[model samples]
Target: MIPAAPLASGRTADVYALDGDRVLRRYRSGGDVRAEAEVMRHLYAEGYPVPRVHHADGPDLVLERVTGPTLVEALVGGDVGVRSAARLLVDLHARLHALPTVRATDPAIRILHLDLHPENVVLAPAGPVVIDWANAREGPSALDRAMTALILAEVAVDRSLPLSAAAHELLMAYVAEAGPLESVAAAARLRADLGAPDAARLPDAVRLVLAAGAPGDRAGAGNLALPDP
Candidate 1:
């Protein structure tokens, strides 16, 4: 089937309206739609809030159309509180990590959404719904949590006060919920090779965020050997 006009576009994919119940997340070249579909299906099976996959043919992924503002949009629009953002994301991350993985690249691991951030979360009527599972895979869950911390750190480094505040709070809470980051010491190399879009910044961001952790944080900046960011 053909998708309608583009609804939104990102660095690697463009979303198109398929119908009232579904939207087509079509990727750019070199995308593995089948693999992405598999991850979504796996998460959905475990009662995650990922969009239900209806079709995955070639570069197009037909997913249940979740209607609501993304967390980023809501935050920018002054619709969501900073503390609430942190708590909700942490809650969601905990839920996601508790689910059994379908593609574990390492032992004693759960599904890892290597690209979870506010922009990927939609404030759905049922609750927060996470989208974008293209980078979903397996390894150490701490690395998964670390990846998110690094992302928010990249934003926390920005000069904008509002952006920095939100990013910093989220970064702090995420790191705290993730427990001691010492667990990711050995996985540094693995995350570096994970092909996350902004991983190049992860090394520096990880160090900065960890060091910037407040006194009350559950995880301290004890000793971290970060990979090249």
Candidate 2:
């Protein structure tokens, strides 16, 4: 199909609206588009809230067009609150991790959405649906949650995405849901090496969360505060 004007663009792909109900995601980088499509298909089949994959061709993927504000947009527009954002963040992972791992080319561990956050979450009419699967991998659930926390921190301390409160609240909620952290430092280091846009800010954010201790503990939820830049 002849490409029309793109509706949105991101670091890894460009989004083009197609026949109203669908959209085309054309990659801007050399990453494995097919792998991304595969991952989406996997999660979709398992009843997870991922955009339905219509087709995938090399760097181009056709996906169901979901309508609704992203959690970040909702927060910015005052359509949602910090407390709601926190719940959404925690709930997104809980729902994702709850699904049984059907397959994996690697260790066959849990499917990890290494980039889950408000920006990628769409509060669709049915509920919240996750988008962007380029950074997904099959790995430990904690590592996945850790990656999300790092991104949240990056938003607050690094990129300053304007939804810093959402990020801050999510981190504490994550701590509450994730229980105790084992190797958050290792997870932060791992994500930093991947060169995400906010990788530079991860160390500081991770340190702050660790310093706050686990949520519900003395320095966590009981004394919860947004660790900002």
Candidate 3:
């Protein structure tokens, strides 16, 4: 087989353009690529806007090539794009979490996309398409929302990007669409369930940006107060 031209490279895989609007992905050996491929296949079959799997050869996968600018690039452009991307994320999370839970009987079947940052989403004419399912697993929707919110907040702060008026709107949208108080409670409960370590690490990871104007000698500091659970 003729070698494919490299399209993109990430920490765990290299994606190459294949013939006729397809892409081939060669994953880092001994990684979770196989499981990711399986998840993609399942979601695609269930009508999610995921890449179509054409074939799987060992650790390599051939999938339909989605042509579009990544959401991250768009968000980095300006306020309008950031707000648009945030709205799309809220919608995507709702749709994904609404999927039948019976299909997630496998312990690995979780609603949480452990990494739901904008970089992993593509904005196509057809709408937003989520990619890079390697870190996805079955879990609470709140964790998913929290992860997305945290990432977006960090990106906004780090890049000196203005938060769109839609930031709170999108958050409220998620709250509204997620239904009655039960859902809100569930989300808060899940966040609390994560325990101190996981919860502490998230804000800490973004502390530099979040606390950009804080006093001196804050580097490597662990004094940030976490929210009461």
Candidate 4:
């Protein structure tokens, strides 16, 4: 057992270091570890820059140790770093979304990094290596984008980590490059609706989306409340 301190914890998983050369991931036993593992494998096979899976035994998984600072830590430096991180995100999303619709339709398919905030991306020698696929699932890309945008906005509000400009640019670039504006718009709305009155509703909405078979328009329905630009 790696006697490493817990690096991070989420609703479904926990991450720890393994002697500074690898990371150990333990999922909540009852959750969708199989699905997550499949998605990780698919993404890796598709050439997306992801941490290499080293071992898997039931709920525990080990992956290659990616070195360097996380995008969130890099963002704290200033606007330039934030903008660079945003650009990397847009690029990564574009590449992932560009995979053939047929391949993307695999039952195991899911949004890559459904929780794509700055913190989930690590800046590596090769580029940005996305981490934390706990929330990943077969879903619309817009939901991923919206989730990332919302998290960035919240960080700005609570932590004074400014990424508004970068976030706006990233959205615009995504729209211009390959994203469906309507879906993005809908996700923005959904975030607003779930965030108000009951902030806890956001996670529920995300779960609902994943359960509904990755439909494209679900994020737009219901009352949507976009954060201030």
Best by TM-score: 2
Error of 1 at 207 (Å): 2.4
lDDT for predicted candidate 4 compared with the true structure = 0.59
CA error at residue 208 for candidate 2, angstroms: 1.6
For model 4, the run of ten residues with the poorest summed lDDT = 205-214
Clashing pairs in 1: 200-229
TM-score winner between candidates 1 and 2 = 2
- Candidate 3 Cα errors over 4 Å, as ranges: 2-5, 78-80, 102-110, 153-201, 205-229
Tens-digit per-residue lDDT, 148-213, candidate 4: 654444333332336545544443443334333334345545556534433534444433333323
Q: Which candidate is the best by lDDT?
A: 2
Clashes of each: 1, 0, 5, 7
For model 3 the TM-score comes to: 0.65
How are the candidates ranked when ordered by lDDT, highest leading?
2, 1, 4, 3
Q: Per-residue lDDT for 147-180 in model 2, tens only?
A: 7766777766644466666567667766666566
Considering lDDT, which of the candidate structures 1 and 2 is the better prediction for this target?
Answer: 2
Per-residue error at 90 for model 4, in Å? Answer: 0.9
Error of 2 at 94 (Å): 1.6
How far residue 113's Cα lies from its native spot in candidate 3, in Å, is 2.1
At residue 5, give the lDDT of candidate 1. Answer: 62
